[model samples]
Target: MKLFADYHTHTIYSHGTGTIMDNVNAAKKKGLKEIAITDHGLRHFTYGVKREKLKRMREEIDEINENNKDFKVLLGLECNIISSDGQIDLDDEAMKYMDIVLLGYHMMVRLKGVPSYVHIYGRHYLSKISKSMAEETRQSNTDIMINAIKKYKVNIITHPGARISMDTGRLAEAAAKTGTALEINSKSNIMTVDYLKVAAGHGAKFVINSDAHKPEDVGNFRNAIKLAEMAGLTSHQIINAVKS
Candidate 1:
């Protein structure tokens, strides 16, 4: 299977090694139909895009599109789920400039304060997570995912349960209900076969995204395709894989 469009990727604006044009160039070389430049949102302490950089980013995307009409470069952000209250870091005003919107859970996000951020990192990043704590975190994470889908016209949920555990069945239900695609993320393999099975049973549609940090990895959908196979998913269930 192959990706028709990769909707989640990062660049030098975040933790990625490549520049925006570099990713676009790689996608063009691969003959992709579209690619989205979804840098980490402002809540990510280390890798998030600076507020001042938006103008440059917009100009770059426009310039790339103006020069090349064969491929489309979408301006987007990997928005952080900042609060337990389902608050996301990207606001409507900031999102107006976006062609695609993606939401993901990250351990390093600034959730209202330093201590809260530290607490989040400390809890999820620890070597061992207790079953009860993991279960609680799962429910909370699922709620946040459902809320984000309900509140925004999110195109994709980057990697649910990739860091924090989540109830995949409910998440799949929400994704199906909202017409939002559940992502089979290439970067993180936390979404298990069991999780995919539950999700598939709920009639959830999936999108396989490279989640590529480097330019050359733009169309690498190997891991996602392998995972989907384990879940007994068919090409009809994966949006991008249909063309492949």
Candidate 2:
């Protein structure tokens, strides 16, 4: 398979095992034209990259670009979605330094104090919450997703699955209107065939990502390709950063 770009990647700067050079080398080995360093944004309690760390990573990328002419590294941030209440941890100034901004729904940090449990299993597996709380969480996630697209003009929404709650169809419409690609992450098996069918029906463009937290995972686009095939995606329906 021809791998053009792997935009969702993590480095040691984001509390991962991979380094900036490790990722770039892996991508070159995989014959990719470009790759992005999209580590978790600041405010993630467990493993997020701070602004200073991001700057350092950017410098490393610049150095690599100056020395190597084979691949391009785009600096990016996987900004965590704070809540369905329209809260985000990253600001515009922070966004200005990034080439791409990706929004993901994870429970590492919840501003509403709804407990970190909401993130581990997402709204789908919560058996202990009251109906009201569940509904609130769901609404909050939907609102956050919509607002993230409107607020940042984000390049893509990363992995809106696994532990997140939102109407896929509605979110797809918002993505289409905002020009934000909805990512099909290979890290988790959350973007089910049915979900892809729904999103594709709404004319949402899909971007494939490795979501590689380690060097070994970089450029492994197998699962994403299978899911896209299951979704009946045509070549024109998928977005390739190099081709774009």
Q: How would you encode candidate 1's per-residue C-alpha lDDT over 180-232 as one tens digit per residue?
A: 88999987888889988888888899988999999989878888889998888
The list of candidate 2 runs beyond 4 A from truth reads: 110-128, 131-136, 241-244
Query: Estimated TM-score per prediction?
Result: 0.90, 0.87
Best by TM-score: 1
Off by over 4 Å in 1: 113-130
| lDDT tens readout by residue for model 2, 34-130 | 8899888787888778777766777888898888887788998888766544556788767766888888877666454564335424554552366
Candidate lDDT (C-alpha), each:
0.83, 0.78
Residue pairs whose backbone atoms clash in candidate 2: 84-140, 84-141
